[model samples]
Target: MAADELKLENQVCFALYAASRAVTSLYRPALDALGLTYPQYLVMLVLWERGPVLVKELGQALDLDSGTLSPLLKRLEAAGLVRRQRCAEDERAVRVYPTDEGGALRDRAMSVPRKLSGATGMGLAELEALRENLVRLTEEITAQQD
Candidate 1:
């Protein structure tokens, strides 16, 4: 109690962690309706944005390591949402792309962000500014780590 920095309530990490969980929980119902987990939703987001991306590029975009990404991709493939194939030029490299069903899911996913944004009770501009700040913070910290 003597040092504010030592208090859990005063920790930025705790705030970020709590906020992340809360926001994720808000997405649960919507994502469940779409038959996607949060992580799966993230992968789909990347796939939806950039079709036919290298597995390594996907891993980097999602900031997930192979150990974590491999299983997730396998599950998605099993679900028939995505497919993995070896690159034609480089047999050692793998590429991931959404299936027809996966691409169709994009239409349903259009409402997800709007729903989450509404839940936040923040205006579009305010939400954008907040997102920009968060991205800057992440980039700065990640740069320091590297």
Candidate 2:
């Protein structure tokens, strides 16, 4: 390949990175309306699906550290969306549970996926293919990390 042809646009990593940012950007305005960031929205999803879960498990699920997640969890608590409680089995462990407000937020948030899908102009099958590819890529990256 020519030196000039080896530019950043030609790199798959760059493309993926840019696409990820772009997709996240599309969510920003919508998320902002709900007073949440992308990471916070992810945390809500996890709580909605799993209910009261440990803080460490949340970090692992989101690939975040305590340094990052602690403050976020605190903010969620302050917002009345979630509550943090010490685990009975382990005083050192903190568990997160969504409040009624948080659970109700899911009803409002249910429209988001459909709105995003419409914005992307991708049909269900195409979206599924994209999701599958991304999942494979994520697994490969996680394997490399190990």
Candidate 3:
């Protein structure tokens, strides 16, 4: 059964990929009501957690490079959900901040996590532990790549 190692069902990457897509799909309806896509919602989460951040920093936090992030930021700006401004002391650096409307949306978005948690039928502690393990696995893989 050596060939079994190559089977799709035995691939950890495929499992994670499938799980990610499934989780993202579950977020769709909730995100749609917020007028935000999954990536946009992620950006908002970072902003809501950390008031304002530089474009470079935001990119790093999201594990996205400028090429992929720029379009998302543009759409977010177009929606008036976020504002991008050049830093006064560093013209080359752009900082992103949530606009008033975006800040207001935070209150309504609070229910999203609770809803998703209930959908999982898992307790907070279990989810948190799983999240920690996933983060560790991601970090290990990333470090290996580096």
Candidate 1 lDDT over residue span 26-80, tens digit each: 9999999999999999999999998988889988998998898889999999999
Q: Which lDDT tens digits does candidate 3 get at residues 1-146?
A: 76776785568888899899999999999989999999999999999999999989988998998998889999999999999999999999999999999999999999987788778877889989989999999999899996
lDDT of each: 0.91, 0.92, 0.92
Greater-TM-score candidate between 1 and 2: 1
- Position 110, candidate 1: lDDT: 97
TM-score for each predicted model, relative to the true structure: 0.91, 0.89, 0.91
Clashing pairs in 1: none
RMSD of 2: 2.2
Off by over 4 Å in 3: 1-10
* TM-score of model 3 (CA atoms): 0.91
lDDT of 2 by residue, 18-70 (tens): 88899999998888888889999999999999999999999899989999999
The deviation in Å at residue 14 for candidate 2 is 1.1
At residue 49, candidate 2 shows an lDDT of 97
